[model samples]
Every structure is written in structure tokens, then in C-alpha cells.
Target: MTQRTPLHPVHLELGARMVDFGGWDMPLAYGSQIEEHHAVRRDAGMFDVSHMCVVDLHGAAVRDLLSRLLANDVGRLKVPGKALYSCMLREDGGVIDDLIAYFIEEGWFRLVVNAGTAVKDLEWIGRHAAQAGVKVAPRRDLAMIAVQGPNARARVVSQMPAVYQERVLALAPFFGVAGGELFVARTGYTGEDGFEVMLPAVQAPTFWLALKAAGVAPCGLGARDTLRLEAGMNLYGNDMDEGVGPLESGLGWTVVLDGERDFIGREALVEQKRRGGLRRLVGLVLEDRGVLRAHQRVLAGEAGEGEITSGGWSPTMERSIALARVPAGTGDRVQVDLRGRLVSARVVKPPFVRHGQVLVNV
Candidate 1:
């Protein structure tokens, strides 16, 4: 049987087009995908992201285990509630998963991983955690709601319990606020300001309805994908997978190799760096009519070939953009083979859009 999130009934009532996303039934869209995407860019939108996995690590060795387990250093998070983005890799230096680690305290840290990779991530963490005497526990009792948009934070705050509202109001970007049974993180896949709130599963409905009453449109995954792509963020499997490393995926900075401390994929990353980054992921903007899509062959002069990782029409910019991996020599002008026809596109740096404005010169 397929799995269901805590908000499944709510989505059904809201007339969402439900689809199976890695076993869990999820909403692809509520109605018009473009309109839902626009709602987030122009106003506020809430997404049912309860399918995401929440794992908690407790005990003295948590920090030590994470530092060795992740490509990024956990010691850098000096303050409580600070979050760090990092990639966990295999012994061969290939990515296991890219995740966010939150430092709540020395003995308590929380990690939010992709739903599809939850089981694998837990297994990976477990395999390494024992070496450092850390306890990795998955928090299945919670549900997550991602409220995104310019007004997302303010709208969510209005409905939070009054006492917790004050603490949430003080949160800075990338920080989390934990009050009572609620945990609000100042983080979002969309470029806009928002929070990923993890609360008791039973409390999700009330909060979901309250946000709706506060004018936050209920968005589905369709809007989420477009927004994040425009924001230049990478989706795990599409942007990079177990076969790819950080250097080519635009996540080199997340790897903190400052110390002699060995990380899982450090040797492979060092070798890749020494080899001069042979291939890389870049953003492309379609100049003509057509949607860019994953695995689409890209041609740049000669016989240079690349593949699009993620692509779609940007509801905010009213154009199409994508992330493509190409040979190191690939340049500005590239052609995408769409439906066996060549479509010209301009290659540019990512973050195609932010704050409701287009970022690249399409």
C-alpha cells in the first residue's frame, strides 16, 4: 500500500491532483500550476511537506559524528538553532544525499532529509554513527509544513500560539526557533522568506487551516519545483546523485576541507579538484518556444554534449530555464535537442529568479 502524509485528507478536500511520490501520495497541483506558482511569488503560499523525514541525534558524540559524517563541519554552528547545509557522501566520494543539519545544542541536533531518501539516509547515518558513539533517531511523530512567500512568515506567526509567536519573530535567516511542541526553521527552498515548521502530527490540521484563513494559498509540489528551480537551488537526484560529486553540482563551498579531519568523500573531491573540474552544471534559458527537460541532450558547437538536470517554464519570469551538466569547455550559447529539433538557449549562472524578479538575462 502507498503511504499518506498527515495532511492527505486536507489536500483531497482542497481538490489537489494526487500522485505517488516515492510511495507517499502527494499533491502535484491544486488547479492551475502556473497560478499556484504565481501566488507564492506575489503573495504567500503553504505546501504540505509532511512527507519529508525528520531525524534527531542526541548525546555527547552527536557533533563529532556529524562532523565526520557530513562534508560540512558541524563545529561551525556556534549558536543554537543555526542550520548548516551539507552533503553526505560514500567512501568513494559520491553523494549519498544533500541535507540540512540544525544545531540545537551540543547533545541534540536535528536533520531534515528528503522523503524519498529517508530510509537510505537513516541507514547511511547509522552505519557511520556507531563509530562515534552517536544515537541517530528518526522523528516519525512530527509533520512538516513549508509556508513560503513574501508574507509567509508573517502569516504563519499570526496563527502560532501567542507565546511562541514572540520567539519565532526573533528568528534570523537559516536559524530555527523551538518552542513547546513546535519547531520553526527560517529556511525554504523558494528564494522568498519563509519557515519549515515541524509540529506534532495531530496539530498539523489546525495549523494548516489557520494558515489558509490567514490568506496563505495552499500550494502543491508543482509550484514548489518551479519556485526552487528559479531560485537556483538543486533537486537531489536531478542536479546530482550518487554518481556525481559536489564540484560539478555547484555545492563545492558546502565542503569544509579546512582541517585534516577526513570526510567520506574528501579524497575523491580532492582528486576531482586537482583534475580541474572537468564538467560542471550550468543554467540555460530557452530563446524559442519549448520546455527544457532532464536528460535532454545539449549541443554547444563541435560535438560537445550535456544533459539537463531540471527544467520547466518559470511561472514568475514567464520563460523556461534549466540546469544542465556539460563538458568543462561548453560556453554561453548552447542548443537543446528538443523533440529531435535543435532549440537555441543561452547559458548563464543559476538563481534564474529571486524575490519575484528574474535574475538572468534571458
Candidate 2:
């Protein structure tokens, strides 16, 4: 049986087309995915991301423990409510999961992880805690809702309690604040201003209702995928896995090599860097009518081939684009094999659309 989130019924009542995502019953779209995506680009939209796991870690040594475990140093977080995005890697340097860690207080951090990988992430975090002498507490009791778009912040804030309303009003981007049992983070996957709220599961329906009343469209996973891809974000299983390293996964910046810390997979990354960086990941824009999809083959001059990891016809840009892992030297002019037909494409940096504007050149 597929797992159901606390707000699953709400999604159904809203006429959302539900599907199985990572073993959980989730919405694919409310009706038209493109319309939902556009809502987020032009106004505000919300997603019931309660399926995502919110784990809270606490212990005297938690700070030091995270600093040692995460590929991105947690020490970089200075502000109390600041959030840091990082990847937890295996000993061999394979990405276990990419998650956001929110620093609330000393020795306490809130980590939100992907639903499918939550159990695995928890196990890995627990194992790390055992060795590092920290405590890992999974917040299964909490549900997450992501409100994204140009007006996303404003729409979501209207639903917050007065105390939280004022606090969130002044909260800067990438920061989070806890209002009673509600934890609001000014962060989201879409390339738009928004918040990802974590609260008790029982309160999910209430919050969802409030957000709907505030005119935030009920967006689903379809829109979320296209939005994140356009924003240059990586999807864990599709973009990278335990078999692929950061250099090939567009996450080279997350790897901290300058430090003396002995994080997992450091040796291999060092070797790969010294040997010349591993094949790089790039964003591709299809000039042709064909849609670019995952696993599609991309061909450059002289038989050079790449593979698309994530692709879609962006509702904001109104064009097909994708993130592809290509040869270390793949060039701008490329062709993607879509259903046996070659489609002309241009390799470009992502954020195909940001703040209601298209970033890619036609």
C-alpha cells in the first residue's frame, strides 16, 4: 500500500490527480501542470510536501557532528535561523541524499530530507551519530508544505499566526523561525520567493486550507520537478546516486576539499580533481519541437554523447530544457535523440526562469 500524507485527503478534495511518488500517494497535478507552474511563476502556489521527512538532531556535539558528516560545512551557517543545503555522501563519495539543514540553536539542527530516501537517510544519520556521539531524532510527527512563487512569501505569511506573521515578515531569505509548533523557513525549490513550513501533522489540513484561502494555487509534483530543474537544482535519484560523484553531478561546490576534515569520499574526489575534473553536468535547451526527457541521448560533434538527467517543457519559459551529464568538453551545439529523431539543442547554464523571468537566451 502506498503511504498517505496527512493532507492526502485535502489533495483529493481539490481534484488533484494523485500518483505514486517514491512509494507515497501524492499529487501529480491539480488539472493542468502548466497552469500550476505558471501560477507559481506569476503569483503563488503551494505543495503538500508532508511526505518529505523533517528530522531534528540534538545533542551537545551535534554541531561538530554535522560539520564532520555533511559535504558542505555547517560552520558556514552564522545566523540562528539560517539554512544550509548539503549532501550526505557515502564513504566512497556517492551521494546518499541532498537535504537542507536549518540551524535553530546550538547543538540543534532541523534537516528536511526526500521522502523515498528518508529511511535510508535516517539510518545513515543514526549510524553517523552513534560514532560521532550525537543524537538523531526523526520528526515524523511534522508535516511540510512548500509555498512558492513571486508572491509566495506574502500569500503564505497571511496564514501565519500574528506573532509568526510579524517574525516571518522580517525574516530574510534562507532563514527560518519557529513559531510555537510551526517552523517556517524562507526557502523553497522553485526559483521564486517562498517558505517551506514544517508543523505538526494534525495541523496540515488547517494550514492547507488557510493557504488556499490566501489564493495560493495547489501545485503538485509535476510543477515542482520542472521548477527545480529550471532553477538548476538536482534531483537525487535521477541526477545523482551512490554510483555518481559530485563532480559529475553539478555539486562540485558542495565538496569541501580545502579543509583538513576527513569527510567521506574525499580521497576519490581529490584524485578526480587532480586527474582533471570528471565529466561535467550541463543544462540543455531544445530549439526543436521535441521534448527533452530523462535518459535521452545528447550528441555533440564527432559522436560525443551525453545523457539527460531531468527535462521538461517549462511552463514559465514555454520551452523544453534539461540538465544533462556530458563529456568533460561538450560544446554549445548539441542534438538530443528523442524517440529516434534528432532534436537541436543548446547547452546553457540553468535558472531557465527566475523571479518570473527567463534566464536562458533563445
Candidate 3:
């Protein structure tokens, strides 16, 4: 059976186009996907991300368990509500999943993971937590709503209850705050500034209606994909999987390999680093009239060949863009095999757009 979010009725009432996303019936679009994409870039937009699971870790061994499980060190998250992005790795250095860990309080931590991998992630976490003597509890009673754009913070804060009004408005980026039953985080996948609010599932409809009344447009997964791509963010199962490590996925920054901290995949990562031959992830832009789609072969003349991991038409840049894993020697120019023709593309650093400004040279 397909699972419906607390806001399913609300989505149906709004005439949203529904689709199956990792077994959950999710909204793909409200009307025009491109228009909805633009709404998030230029103004404010909201998404029902309740399908993403929130798992809480408790007990004295919580930090120790995380230290051994994740690629990034959790010891860095000292201050309460500080969020750290990390990749959980297998013993062989393959990425199991990417997640956000929030230090809520001593002996308590919060983790938000991708919806598709929630079940496996929980199983993996539980297996390790058992050894560490920690408790892993999934917070199924909560729903998450992400309001993103330049005006996102202001709109969401204004609609929040007075008790949380002051604290939420004062939150810093990459931080989260908890008041009563609500947890508001100043974090988002979209490059634009925003807040991801987690509240009791029953209150979701009321809050969604409040945000809609405040002029926040309801966006779906269609827009969310394009927005995150333009932001140079990685989508699990597309950009990476259990076969790939962070080193080759443009996510080496999230891996903490220093010091005596021995985390999962640390030894494998060290061995891979010493081996030296690895494909590199790069951003590609097609200036000519064409769309770049995933799995397309990329040719770098005599340099080498690679494949596009994630590709799409960026609504913000108004052009075709992609994240491709090509030869380490691949230069600033490459050709994407589109259909039967090899199309030219310029390689540039990612974050194609941020805060309504195009970062790469178009």
C-alpha cells in the first residue's frame, strides 16, 4: 500500500499532479513545473517533505555510535541545534546514505534522512546502535515542510505561533531550534535561504493553509529536483550509491579522514586515496539549444570518457546543466552524447545559481 502524508487531502484539493516517489504518493507539480521552479527562486515556495524520516538517537552511547558510523565527525557538533551534513559509509567505503545530524542536547541527537532509503537506513542504524547500546526511534508523528526562497524566512516566521516567533526568527543558517513540539531548522536543499519546519503531523494541514494564505506557493518534486541540481546538491541513488565513495562524488568535503578517529569506510577511503586513479565529478553547461539528461555518455576528446550522473534543464539558469563524473584529466571542455549527436559543453565549478544569481558564467 502507498503511504499518504498528512497533507494528502490538501494536495488533492489543490489539484496537484501526484506521482510515486520511492513508494510514497507525492506531488510532482501543482500546475506548471517551470513556473513553480521560478516561484522558489524569485519568491517563496513550500514543499511537503513529510515522507523523509526523522530518527532520534538517545542514551549515553549516542555520540559514540555516530562517531563510528558516519564519515563526518559528530564531535564537531558541540553547540545544541548545530547541524552537520554527513555520509554514512559501509566498511568498504561505499556510501550508504547522506544525512543531516542535529545535536539537540546532551544524550539526544536528531537525524533526517532521504525518504527512499529511510527503511534501510533505520535498519543499518539500529544494527549499529544495538552494539553501541543506544536507542534509535523514528519520529513518525512529525511532518516536515520546507519553505524556500529569499522571502521564505520572513513569511514562515510571520505565520509561526507567537511562542516560537522570536526564537525562530533569530535562527542562524545551518542551525535548528526546538520549542514545544515544533522543530524549525534554518537549513534547506535549495541554494536559496529557507526554513524546514517539523511539527506534529496533525497540525500540518493548518500550517500549510496558513503558509498558503501568506502567499507561499506550493511547489512539488518537479521543481525541487531542478532547484537542487542548480544548487550543485547531490541526490542519492543518482549522483552516488553504495558502489561509490564521497571522494568521487564531489562530497569529499563531508568526509573527515583526519586524526585517530576511525569511522566506517575510513580505511577503505585511505586505500582508495593512495591508489590515485579516480573519476572526478564536474559541472557541465550546454549553451547551445539542447537538454542534458542523466546517463548520457560524455566524451573529452582524447582525454577520456565519462557519464552524466545527474542532468536537467535548469530553470534558474535557463539552460541545460549537469553533474558528470569524467576522467580525472578531463579539462574545461567536453562533449555530451545527446541522442545521436555529440553536443558541446563547458565544464565549470558547481552551484550554478545561488540567492537568485547565476554563479557560473553562462
In candidate 3, what residue range of length 10 has the lowest lDDT sum? 279-288
Looking at model 2, residue 209 earns an lDDT score of: 92
Candidate number with greatest lDDT: 3
- Candidate 2 segments exceeding 4 Å error: none
Residue 169's lDDT within candidate 2 is 82
- Candidate 1 lDDT, 201-274, residue by residue in tens: 99898889989998999999988999999999999988988999888888887998887978788888888888
Clashing pairs in 1: none
Against the hidden reference, what TM-scores do the models get? 0.98, 0.98, 0.99
Model 3 ranges off by over 4 Å: none
Task: Rank all candidate structures by their TM-score, best first, as comma-separated numbers.
Answer: 3, 1, 2
Q: Can you write out model 2's per-residue Cα lDDT over 270-347, one digit (the tens) per residue?
A: 877888837778899899896899999888776378899998887766788999998877778898899999989998
In model 1, the runs with Cα more than 4 Å from the true position are none
Candidate 2 or 1, higher lDDT? 1
State residue 212's C-alpha deviation in candidate 1, in Å.
Answer: 0.4
